[model samples]
Target chain A: MAVCPDFSIPAPFFYVNTFYDILYQSEDAKRIFGEHANFFSLIDVESRRKFQRLAERRFEPQKFELLLNTVQSPAMLFDIHLKWNRDNHCSILCIEQSQRYQQITEVLTRFTQRLGMTNYDLLRRKEELERLLANLQQSNAQNDRLVELGRIAASIAHEIRNPLTSIRGLVQLLAPNLTSSAKLSYIDIIISEINRVNSIITEFLKTAKPAPPLKEAIPVTDLFAELELLCHSESLLQGIELVILPVDPSLMIYADRLQMKQVLLNMLHNAMEAISDLPNSRTGMIQFEAERFGRYVQIRIEDNGVGMDEQTRTHLFSPFFTTKNSGTGLGLSTCYHIVELHGGTIDVESTPGHGTVFRIYLPTVDKKPELS
Target chain B: MNATHNNRFFQASLDLTDSIRMKIIQFAHILLSGDERKSWEFIEQQLVNGIHSTEIFCTYIPLAMTYIGELWIENAISVVDEHIASCVCDYLIMRYQAQYITPPDQQNCQAVVACVDGDPHELGAKLAVLLLNRHGLQTHYLGVHCPLHHFLAFISKWRPSIVALSVTQSHHLKKVQDYLEALQGLPYQPEIIVGGRLIHHLSYTSSKGAPNKQRLFFMQNLHELAGWLEQDYLPIKPE
Candidate 1:
């Protein structure tokens, strides 16, 4: 043990030889070692061997000398070195490392705090990035939809122009003829074509306009019953089964009567097209059922027609995705928009060749009807 | 009184026991057949008796039905048809997960199971979650094609013990590598374990510049995965 010249008693400093005794026996020594102090004494034989190997690699002789000599400040330096002595006792050089250790601890604490702040900043930035990404994706989807709408509009315009040109030519060709019946017939044909063109234009324009507000308390059963009659008549003509389940009388949707009817008609037309073809034995079933959901009236139109695959189902409500031979794909797309405008959502569930179910939810009127 | 007792009480009890036994046998057969709807129905019926679907599906069904489909496939069942069956079974399993009301024990080790980006087949990942959950591990399932950055953010915040990644298709190799590289840079990186069909597609060629740079220990199927999880990955102690 090292001794001070001025004192007759021991200096209370732990020397290299008595270091293990001090670390194991003294609470003050254990406090300096932290949680690792117990590990030094309590480790089993195999663990001690492994730890010794690691310690040897980490605490080399040159690094030990540097650690001891680097303390220039007037503070207790505890150079804790695990070494073997002549007596084969575990020796730890307990020089006063307090001042240098405090400096290192302060530097490390600051670094760790800065690291934590950086991590928090990174997290905030990541959240912002995710939000931006989600927005970008939504915008891209909208852009794609707009482009598809534009294409459909161009084709529709071209179709209308061709018919208009034909009507114009027919009018010009029949200009010289002067007969009452013949003129009336030609005028009737022209008027019908003009009406068709007008209807097409009106439907296309409706897509851009906000849905008209609900003005009337229309009976849900009556509306669905009328739809059922129409579907049944169409089915009779086309040799297909059109089934409408009994509508729930309590399920009244607060919606514009004309707009809601239009939505239902479009869905019914789509269903008719879907099931138009089948061998008589494997003919598809079309069903329309109404049920009252919480705060909303749900109308489900299900078809056992050739149901769509995932890819088709994903874009099923997108404007102008049609498998029809001579029909505008705008039908269901318009229905979807109108439903959305009325504070409602449309969901479709389908399995290929199994069936499709289109569920439309609309808010129900619970309060007294407002006079318009 | 003796005749009444024999007719009403003793006979009714015997009938009830016979019905219960019969139902259980039928349920076992349906499970062995891999009929999802029938299995669900059986599970619902057994609910009154307090039998859990998770226990039946994870233990009994997999043990008996694992090789049933293989035999059928060998005897001329189409591969595409097998995929459809797998899809149905996976869907049912997910439905059960959705409907499961009993809260998983939070005291157990928690894990995040996800499919690497571009690997859209989620059946394998779903199966892994079911098996892990059966073993009493809490699992947070992030479905197929989960973006890498989102996963990293979740990992940092949640700090789960294990991150189980599934890559079903070979096309997701680049994305998986990118995910691993990103994980290496994270502050709270968990122990990463990967499996699925894509691993089988990877070769062990030692040539430089080849796509297969490292030998990923591939798990053949869900059984292998369950074994690996139970033996090597469970009971993770927090650092």
Candidate 2:
């Protein structure tokens, strides 16, 4: 009995067990349908054909969306469920309900104002999740590094002790056979070899305990400029090309300028070495680009050198992890440590024959007060 | 609510200057960093007590958290940042909902709110549930995309005086229609309400249906819904 003009609920308040017969409808059903018509009959021609298929199959009453219309009412779509029953004489049943579509559009405009806030929060949580995962992995890697160091410590002590003992006995034995000058020369040779060993140990210590960078606001553009000038001679000597793309002059990062130079120089040297090691290596290319991205400044150094294999790349940043022989195997590791100290992330991409790319992201320095 | 009162409330509650808007965005970032304590404190400091808290929440969301889809299109914020801000807002809204107290003398009218299946957006529906409850209506919240069976089972058992169904996706509009179909045979007839972001484009609603003789009240926000409940349903003492 309650009704409004913009929306309608015109279900016939009647039930029919058979759609094919009208006799089954009781007087009340007849009266309601006679005036309002059966909800199914109110549907358009196309839908009745569709509804007939279900009735023909004697399927259970199912809801089919149809636009219902009557002489006095406007055309509106309703999910009307209809079925025919023939077991006891014949019967049919119908129901219809709908709202003005405009109502929903208005509601959506209101809801969108709120949904945006929910979305922003979800992304923040995702970033936290990634950060937490990274921290867990770093901790595990650190524990592994400690275990490796303990083993290396024992081996190093044995290696050094054996050499000193051999030198002591040999020196005493030679003391009787040689002139004073000859003895001094022989002792000098021994000292030189010992110094070589000491240098290797020093490299290991430097990697084991890295000092934090003294951060200052330095322009990333300047870093790229200095790097190009520094590597200019090296690139030419190795038949390599150095490309430095123009970047925003004001783009600045809070990092130790000296350490950042070291990070880039090491990467450039590695690129050259990789190219030289390859058979029939063409003229090498090392491209460096610096730019500000969101709250960070990114420095990307790419090279056309023989790249690392998956196995070598995995341990590329670990302390004392290196592919080069005849060195302490800690060049790249030292670079990584310096970058981390500046609150930056380093990512490396390499393909066996294709090339290598090192992308460094450093948090940009903002002197302005953060509102929140 | 009168237009003058609405305007006054909006102006008083959301004086969202550029600086305040920027600060709100910064707070969203802080909230994302899991500094819940600091974010709430910042909000409290900026939004003083004289402003109706709900009005502030309703009016200022547009400034602080613009439509995410539009933001992504404009490249103003990454999809992830927008998503994070949205999630933080949802959490804040839920925090507000938890503190909303029901009046002692509740109305006899009971309303059941449920989202149609396949539509997971529940913020609007949840707001309706919380606001209705605060206004002394006995409201039950059946969360996002409730299966049709569960919805019907609860409706039959509780026999609520009204039912609010929310669907945020157009594809899920079918579910809304299906629900209306199922609601037809109930002995205790309840007023049915459907809401969602894509509710306007609900396929069936596109038809040019002229005014019919059945009553259905459409509400765009809690304010409008609140007005209807107070004016028609709730008892009003002489003012």
Candidate 3:
């Protein structure tokens, strides 16, 4: 309303009365807020409240900040300076601070990028630590197993060595004395029995010092194929139906191939033996299956044979435990040890007249990251 | 272990007014008969039908075991039958817990559930572990008959925030007291939650002399325990 006065300052400046009537505006301010805009209409609500609080104080030179609506931006932050003149009108100056805000935003973006990298590094390191811990546990279990085996191996050697040697020597000496076919067959049986004893001793020694597992991702179907091939002849000989269910192609486990085969073979051998004892009138059958169960691969071997009682089931994994007449009592315990060494567990359930089921749960290897 | 299924297993849905109660009764009968396969089938079917796991655990399993206990109390079943039923229930609970896959990002709230020495019943403790685990807690279940020294050694190593003890027999009060005293001796004291069939015995002034009574809580049933866990104890959101 006053005659258009030229301001001395070059920055965006304004003069307004106590009611916020725009008495004067610099050319730059006019370009930003428009020619006829009120001072209150230029700021956001929050800044209006702040301005009201500031106005309640005594009229003096003051410096503050406000978010202003300008031609360039919706809510631009501005450093505002205000002073009251003798005419009771206030003169105001606003310095745009968008460049400073941009610098602060750049710093924050860098901070967040660094934080994300740190989180990824921490996760990678945690995975490494977990792998190391698993290896340490496996080593500890192996050491304990070796110590227990050493204790039993010494006594077993002392008990079997001299008798085995004498039996071999006697069989060789009597080889020429056998003239008839029936006598030759008896000598053959004696030699084979001695060889079986020697083989049992060797198998027991292998349990004492097992090679560390060469763990790798292996498809379960491939392993099952090998097992079916190896057990095919034995199943044919015993007339037991060995039915291995088809495994999922994507199911995989981290394990030693040879040791895993040994575990399956041992279980298959036990299953066949169990079925061989069944009556001829009843048909014998063994079912082998492997499936993904949560984070583990569950290998299940079930047999419709003469099952074991609770007492036998409890001691089935002991070092020198067996219920068979010609059994060495070492196969199952060795299987148990090998499974433990692979960071797996084996559980058995059986009813005396029905059947037995052996379930081996091994940790699965996840190939897809998104699946997790 | 027995993967084969047959008609004896319960696979059909129910249509009774009190379906949960009927299921509980039938499950108790199955457990008493030592038919684990049937019981597993029943549970799996329930889970497959979209029943909430909390209802299955906090209502079905515990209620079934309680019915078995009641039958044993009334002399309908022998002691051996009761033991067999308990063992079957324990095995199913073990298998069920083994199948739980916790989310990797969930922050763990550690808990230890055990039965006092000389208490033969562990179903209550096992159920507690299952329910707590379902609520985003990492629980270690030390089954019945763990010696005190071994327990203390484990507790010192594990240093859980909660210790849950199940006591079925009132005569095991001495063992509970011993455990409480030993737990108090540790550098980190956990909140002790005592619950079981004989939980009311503690309310009869016998727990006044127990060590760290301020930290002891008597939970009547799993529902109350779960409520407490949701309202006060569960520090993380349930998954």
Tens digit per residue, CA lDDT, model 1, A172-203: 57755736455655554465546556655655
Which regions in candidate 3 have their CA more than 4 angstroms from the true location? A1-372, B1-17, B102-109, B203-214, B234-239
Q: Name the runs in model 1 displaced over 4 angstroms.
A: A1-215, A323-329, A370-372, B1-239
What is each candidate's DockQ, to 2 decimals?
0.01, 0.02, 0.01
Q: Rank the candidates by TM-score, best first.
A: 3, 2, 1
Q: Which has the greatest lDDT?
A: 3
Q: Higher DockQ: candidate 2 or 3?
A: 2
Task: Judge the docking of candidate 1 as incorrect, acceptable, medium or high.
Answer: incorrect
lDDT tens digits, residues A1-372, model 2? 212121122334334334443433434434433543344665554345345544453546554444345444434445445544445322334443435445543554465555434444465577679887897687668768866986788578657766776776677677666664566655644554454455445444565565556578888887887677557887898777888899988888887766777788888888888888877747778898988778898889898888989998998987655577754556788788788787788998999998999999999976542332
- Could you give the candidate ranking by DockQ, starting with the highest? 2, 1, 3
Q: Give each candidate's fraction of reference contacts reproduced.
A: 0.00, 0.00, 0.00
lDDT of 2 by residue, B1-239 (tens): 12233233223335456555555556555645545445555555655755465554544443344333333323344434554555555656655554346432333437889887766567677667766776667788888757899989988987777788877654466666677767765665566666654455554442334112142344445565656666765332223
Clashing pairs in 1: A76-A96, A76-A97, A77-A95, A77-A96, A77-A97, A78-A95, A78-A96, A78-A97
Docking tier of model 2: it is: incorrect
Estimate, for each residue in A253-363, the C-alpha lDDT of model 3 and write its tens digit.
888776787789899989888888777778899999999889899999999998999899999998656788767577999899988987899999999877899999999
Q: How far does residue A265 in candidate 3 sit from its true spot (Å)?
A: 49
